[model samples]
Target: MSAPLASLPPRRLSWQFLRLVTPYWKSANKWQVRGYTLALLLFTLAQVALAIWMNYWSRELFDALEDKSLNDLLMQVGTFVLIFILTMAVTALHMQVKRWLQLDWRRWLTAKVLDQWMTRGHHYQLQLVGGEHDNPDGRIAEDIRIVTESSIGLVHSLVYSLLIFGSFVDILLTVTGSATFPGTAFMVPGYMVILAFAYAGAGTVFGLLLGRPLITATNKLQTAEADFRFGLGRSRSNSESIALMHGEDIERQNAKTFFARLSQRWNRQTLGYLGIVSFSSGYGALLPVFPILLMAPQYIAGGMTLGVLMQAAQAFQKLTSALSWPIDNLGELAHCRASIQRVLSLYNDMQVLDEQASEPQEHRISVAQSTQHELVLRDLCIANPDGLILLEGFNQVVRRGEHVLIAGDPTVTISLFKVVAGLWPWGHGEVWLPEGPAISFLPQRPFLPHASLQSVLSYPQPAEHFTQAAMHHALECAGIAWLAPRLTELDSWDRVLPLRAQQRLGFARLFLQQPAWVFIEEATDAFDPKGEEGMMDMLYRELPNATLLTISFHTGLERHYQRKLLLNRPAQDKYLTCSTSECSLTTAPVTPVVTAAD
Candidate 1:
């Protein structure tokens, strides 16, 4: 029976996002975040000091030049040299500190998100509604990289802007005070504030107006590109099938059409980017002149010295940096936000299903009673993802050494194995397998990780764990001895091997591992009847004492088993089950336990 988790889940983005991000701080390198933060704090404080001293140095050096005292000139020169040295050292240290911090943060974030992707079985369950709903592979591998890099860069730029603003604001106010219109104190605080806000708002609004569309466009384009790539992959992997069907021209035409869409979207995005750059670059070059124009009157009236004039110019440049923080980060910030929304949406959708398990499955599976049977699913009930009732009160028992065959419905058997393997969580009723029994499941599509042949042969166990003799023996038993010579030659053996060969390898591992119980799905679905019989013979010979449970609708293998069970989708509420004609294949219905917390 499948695990039941039927409930709507909470998906407030802010809270869920925080829950997602919290795991990074709990990683093994947590102390590194602390150490880097301390260094950044010290470096930031030092940077502020240096910036302030430079402002004072500007005025003092000009004063010394006006006085023309050799002693004062020498003193100013030496002080300037020392200030330069200190500034260089501080900047270098800050750079190194930030580099490590950025990398540390990225590593922590990627690892945490990746582990979550693999842990919840969301990666597999996500496959059902399969037109690129969520690619955990892309999310973990690429999206995390973008988010981490963009986030760190944004933080650094914001911090630097804050320090620059703090260092120059006082100097700016003093320089502006020296200027006057006749007699009344010149007041331009309001003008400066208004300008800052206007500049930031314009860039933000413009960037969003032009850039937001690109994010969504790029995401769509990426999916299309992946589809096109996957089509090519299919061509490569199923060359024999494609060739037999004479689909070369058909596939070529389809691929050309897919690439055409990809090209169309990319071209539009390029134009959008060009439009943004045209507007932004115009603003950048014109910005430096505005500060000088605002302060021109002070220098002309002799209200400020050359040093004070330079300081005022620097201040205006500094002000632009402060006002333009968002503008500078607009691209990265947009991409980061887009990625956040995407990842957040996926996490929410995946989690939303099992939030509270409020809706119980039609067939309630539970432990009616322990019968000292090898396996017992009491009053088991399950439904397809589309609400099609698959199995109801699907009672079954496997004796200690009996080989049981579950036949009749192809869809039913496949769904049942998924539920029993503890991979599918959409069904109800408790499936009781003795806790101590070792259960090994082989699905129709088995996982083939990228590694050496030896590593592939000894999957779930590292390559080093298996002896050379054992490696050859296992491959030979699986009739995959063609790989024996390449045991040390590492590659993607799973993809390289034929589906039949891979299943043979899976069976070989099953036999070699000698699990207490073996649950076989349509692992041999792609193979001929003879091949299926051959593999079953090998399985029995290898694990004569092991309890064998098989799911097959072929009926050809029916002769191999003593106990046979069948299932059908009778209705939305009732799933059909029949063991033999006279029995009517029915069992007592189970009452599922549900609590408020459940």
Candidate 2:
């Protein structure tokens, strides 16, 4: 039974939407959300009460006009002024309350999504392992806004419509009462209500059928829009590179391609809207005359007054409007559905990542804290996600205070660094680390976060953690003292600073932190040999007891390390072979080289 229910299309979609939105209602802001919800409910009830009063007023005004009673018409006109003022107040308050709730919900949702996306480097993993979530930034920024506003608007409209239907259905039944055909025994009770239902129900069925393609079209439009925006952002970020390469034409063509796809989806949505409008317009235009046509004989026979005929028409309109919600807002419904699906897809992906991290796996690298003051890798096997072995059966230990250089195929060396840093764990291995040593890893191109120069220098740490004097000293030792005075200034320091300056800053951070263990991945490659030597000399001078593991192609740094490790891969094999060489202070120069078969 549950399986069958799950197989139902509407139920599946509703379940997905509820799952995506339930977190907000149950979140820490539940009390505030409930307060806003209560206000909206009261507003909706007020509107319904106003509608009922106005319906009766309409009948009274019309009957006064029909009888040519000037005094009654003047009194009804005064009543109209009061009703209009109250309606305006109610409408304004409703809109303000709705907007307030939308903003609060959007704020909470944005924070929640950002936290989930950024936690545990899940955002990086998503980019590395591409899947259905193409552009998370758009989902968090644009889709969340659409979902919150549209869902609230739609729910309010739906609830109000239902209230109107309930209040006016009895009025319609009372006015139309029962109809009997002449010379026939058949009688249809509350025929006005039944006619309104049948008319609106048919229109709804046709509306849904005509609007079915809109959901897919809207989804495609959103994706294409995100892709196009991303393309524009990428072009802006890489403007300097493009300008240097004179690739303006290529970039323009890429923009045109993305725009073309977006336009195609827009055209499809337009066509879908055409069908919906054509049907809904005709259906709605005929509603006012429907009740009149059904009761014309009673008015002609003097059984119904002009006011009663008008009242019956008004009640029928209300009942049909309530039942025609799907027909009126089908396009919005499609858009809401698409937005909900996109957000839920992102949420589900994050959940999947969390689940994968928690579950035990046979191939996961075993990591533990060790009593020994060294970093150890025992029988380590590193492989890509596709199971292509990069390094296998490798066992090694780097004791405390050892300066070692690993020279290998750039890919393998980088992978090894990531493995040791515990970023890449899709392999069989056991890694043991000294229990209480702070470690830092610097990659080939250091990351300078978008922050104050001080924050960027002391990153993964707050700006206040280091004194201005310490930062100045580290900068001077790293041979980039020119940056010391600008530490307080904030900007996109990553883009503002030159490559050599950024690399110098990485070392500056290392000097300030003075971690017990440091892993360097070609961090000094951007610097000239003399500059590289100066930075290396500063490292040895400042943190003499720190264990240094450097991965670099330049053999010029060979004299700085007391030991060397090399990785080799033969053409016939899939795994790497590791070899180590120990050197003494007086040993002759030995260049460590890594060769991999094509």
Candidate 3:
């Protein structure tokens, strides 16, 4: 992230970030990208041509001004108008084409990042692990915005400067004629090139000494601003709690203080910009006078025409533009480097996580579709973030329609269910599930997306994706028939509805869908003892042939299941086999004490 440094370690800047970008170009749509790049190349050439034309116009206009010829002035004016019109037209068209590329590139980038994030369920796993830094949404929205827009601007500036340099070099050399240097046959006008170089070098050095520190400051300031924005968003999301607790005053105080710092940085940035503007303006004003001073005597003495003298002045200004590249584009260059560095850091983090997950210590997890008719786990071992092995050297055969109760500590057993459901894959294991799987997973806190009741029931898809009858039946069966009228009404269900009602809707979804495998992670705990029993009875009534895998800490849940499995942490006691009839792992009347001594 030390992007302010003039020279970054090549290994840190583009190397890793380029790795992330490599996937998109390698995609099936790479031809589209190739075409886009080809178009960009052509666009660049056209812009360069325009720049050269601008240099020609600058010289021609100045020469006309000096001679005061009415006919010549009219001719120059007409030519200038035509070229200026062309310039604006080309600029507008280029923007349109560049926008097309931006959208395509953004679409491609979003899909690729989302695919990887949701690919192996990395998005969910990221929440549980160090992938908090993944921030895929941020990468998709903000980071991509900066990377795209800034890149286009950077490319345009570069091409413009280079073209100006190439075109103006001829004028500069022609003006010098050849450096006599006290007794020489003329040195091929190298003296003019040297003069331009020295001026550019001096400007860059002085500017850097006074202003380079601003680039470093800008980088830090941006990071701080992002952090502050995240904080505000966090508070906004918890507005309800904040209001109830009457913490708005505190929030306002904090935000005011935060924005105050932001304003301070903004002012510093303004000062830096002003200093740059002052320097460039001074350089620009002196330019016209400078060429005249050098070549005016030569022109009056008949060494060259009024046209040639004016041409040399235009050439000198254009040459200076080329040399002043760093000074001219300092802001954009800093922003680009900072953005590139961030993406590089993110890419490196993902790679590091990939390596750690596959290492022997973490037991690299693998997933495959069940070839046969059953869900099977061979040599399955689930673990904690700290490498605490929960399920070790395990083998299990899940028949098509067996209700299995996993009766261990709530957390570890639920993790096992996730591992089996193919949601969590951080631990070392093999989960073999049936092909074209239909599964209904109910976590302790079910996710209810903001949508209509029907869409909420559908959860991950639209209401139109499923039949109205099916959704109605689900609501009725789950004892939520009242919600039937609200199926077409769309609102934020997460905020409007209570947790228990959401769980009822969840159960209704399971009952309606009737998936072959139903994974419940302490979902039924929402209801009281009577309600739990009634719901279980309804579940059995609906899906008599379906398999139910429940994870619960409550031992009372054991009686409802035909099979039970226990799990414990890695750093704790060893795992021992136990039977349903009698078990020594349970000594507490209500709590289960698991140990190796069964």
Lowest lDDT 10-residue stretch of candidate 1: 1-10
lDDT of 3 by residue, 1-598 (tens): 1233225764656665566666766678788877776677676678767766776776677778778878888988998898888878877777777777777766776666666666556666656665324345565567667776777677767876887788678767866575454465655465666777777888787766666656766765665576678669878867767878999999998888878888887777777777777877787677668767866666777877776666676677778878788887887776777666555545445555555455552245566676676778776766565544556666777777887877766667877777866666655657787665666678887888777778788767556778988888888888889989999998877667766887888898787667778888889777887878788888989999888888776666666787777765544543322233322221211222333211
Q: Rank the candidates by TM-score, best first.
A: 2, 3, 1
lDDT-sorted candidate list, best first:
2, 3, 1
Per-model TM values vs. the true structure: 0.82, 0.89, 0.84
lDDT tens readout by residue for model 2, 1-598: 0122212376687887677667887788798899888999999999999999999998899899999999999999999999999999999999999999999989988898889998866786676554567789999999999999999999999999999999999999998788887999999999888889999999999999998888778878988999999999899877877888999999999999999999999999988888888998898789888889889998899887888889989999999999998889889987887877778778777776676455453345666689889999887766664445666667788888999898867766787887777666655668888667656998877888878889998998997989999999989998889988788888987677777888888999998888999999999999889988988998999999999999988989988998788864323334222223321112222222433221
Which candidate comes out best when scored by TM-score? 2
Provide the lowest-lDDT 10-residue window in model 2.
Answer: 582-591
**lDDT digits (tens) for residues 1-598 of candidate 1:** 1211111132454455567777666667667777787888789889878877887787777767766778887898999999999999999999898778767776776765555556546666667633224555565555666766776667777887787776666667666563335678875553443454576568767866766566556556555665677677768877766777999999899889989988987786677677677778887887777766766676677766766766666666676667678666666665665565556555554554334133333322333234464787766766655444666656666667788887656777787787776556555677777545557887776777777777776778787876898778877777777878987786776556777888887876776677878888877887888888887888888788888888877878877776776666543354334222311223343332211110
lDDT score, candidate 3: 0.70
Candidate 2 local lDDT, residue 419? 78
